[model samples]
Target: MWLFVVLGAVLVLVGAVWALQGFGMLGGSAMTGSTLWAVIGPIVALVGLALIVIGIARRSRSS
Candidate 1:
């Protein structure tokens, strides 16, 4: 449960960075200004959010 939360948080941060880079908000990377990253980033973030929700739900249920 805790593992899920930790992993999810990391993924969320990574996804945010990817999205920013994709949108040209962040630079100096190969992914900057790439449309593919722009699309993939949000998807990854959503997945992370789902994992976080699952972790929280499971933790609450166990408690």
Candidate 2:
């Protein structure tokens, strides 16, 4: 469960960065202003959130 939570958090951060880059909010990368990342970023973030929720729930249940 902890693993899930940690991995999820990492994914969420990465997704946020990707989203920012894709939207041109962050620069200095090829991904900056790319439409593909803009679309995929939120999806990855949502998956990360789901993993976090699952991890928490599993932890609670195990306890």
Candidate 3:
């Protein structure tokens, strides 16, 4: 549903930011350069991508 798409988009955006911060590409945070965030960020982004795919698939089926 639209909700899934919205949530997925938000997650992707947040994950990207977290990843950037974790990689020290984006500064000004305690999480900057943290290995934990660096690892988890990609996972979260992947999950968001999955959600978006699932939402689109369902939408297409329903239509």
The CA lDDT of each predicted structure is 0.92, 0.93, 0.90
Lowest-scoring 10 consecutive residues by lDDT in candidate 1? 39-48
lDDT of 1 at 33: 100
- Give the clashing pairs for model 3: none
TM-score of each: 0.97, 0.97, 0.96
lDDT of 2 by residue, 4-61 (tens): 9999999999999999999999999999999999988888898899899999999999
Q: How big is the positional error of residue 58 in model 3, measured in Å on the Cα after superposition?
A: 0.4
For model 2, the superposed segments whose C-alpha errors exceed 4 Å read none
Model 1, runs deviating above 4 Å:
none
What is model 1's C-alpha RMSD?
0.5
Colliding pairs, model 2: none
Model 1 misses residue 43 by how many Å?
A: 0.6
- lDDT tens digits, residue span 1-63, model 3: 887888898889889989998999999999999999998888888889988988898899999
- RMSD (Å) of each candidate, 1 decimal: 0.5, 0.5, 0.5
Ranking by lDDT: 2, 1, 3
Question: What would the TM-score be for candidate 2 when compared with the true structure?
Answer: 0.97
